[model samples]
Target: MELFVFVCAAIMVLVGALGVVLRSNPVHAALSMILTLFGVAVLFVAREANFLAAVQVIVYAGAIVVLFLFVIMLLGVDRAEDLRTEPLGNVQRPLALVLGIGMFALLTTAVVRSRDSLRFKGDGVKTATLEDADGNIRQIARSIFGDYVVAFELTSVLLIVAVVGTVVLARRRKSERTAS
Candidate 1:
């Protein structure tokens, strides 16, 4: 069951990546990236990283993607002209292709090596230390407040800034229209 879910999530992520790369419209690309982030979150949940999964969905899928979409909408990018400009042409094309191929080969080698070396005992997965609900909750609380407090605070501040900036931009646009 877990394997099946993982496979589906992987497929979704791959399709989303392709869509992000191939789509002509910036909005579509941003949406695709959101889908990719959602798949990653699902994968994290399947792996029993519940807190991480929630953070992935909340931070990346919800906040970051919405910000990206808002920026795309605010810019009012011309779809036709944006599509016409081949940004990856000329000098960057061959370099990008070579780098991509090299990265793929390196990743493939690493995966193969890891699979061959890594061994699983019993049911093939280690039992998590915080198995009980209360234990898990405590573990999560400690990790967040103890180790990641600064990061958590920073994320909240960042979100606040994003919200304020969006409102300011919208108000400025409305004031400009009224003046005109």
Candidate 2:
């Protein structure tokens, strides 16, 4: 049953990824990304990372995808276009292909050569005990608030700044249109 769920989620992820890459429509691509995010959430659940699964669904699939669609609709990029035309000229396609293949080769070489370095070298991860109902949550909270508090706070501030900036830009544009 576990294997079946994993396989199904993996397939969903792969198909969604392909849809994201291959779809010409921005809305369709964003929807595909949602599918990918949901599949990732399922995989996180399979790994017993319930918090991460919830974050994946709520933060990525919900908030981030909504932001993407909002931006797409705001910028009016939902129209069909000629996919064959190269906006960056003929050189970019070949250059991109070469760079992609080189990157793949480098990644493959690193993974093959660094097999031993991937093992966990630190002490065992601290997990919640069976008796403590909120052990996992407590440990996660401590790790996030105690160890990575600054990073977490900074991320929140940055997101807030981004939202404010977007709103300001949109208001400015609207005022300009009214003035015009």
**Using lDDT as the measure, which candidate wins?**
2
C-alpha lDDT of all candidate models, in order: 0.80, 0.84
- With a 3 Å backbone cut-off (N, CA, C), the pairs that clash in candidate 2 are none
Q: Candidate 1 residues 1-180, lDDT tens each?
A: 988999999988988998898788888888889889888989987887777788899989878888888777888872634544777678787798899999999999999889967766543332246456445456677778988999889989998998899797766666788998
Relative to the true structure, candidate 2 reaches a TM of: 0.80
Root-mean-square deviation of each candidate, in angstroms?
A: 5.1, 2.9
Could you tell me every candidate's TM-score relative to the true structure? 0.69, 0.80
Off by over 4 Å in 2: 1-3, 86-88, 123-133, 173-175, 178-180
Query: What would the per-residue lDDT of candidate 2 be over residues 45-83, giving only the tens digit for each residue?
Result: 788677778888999987899999998999999975556
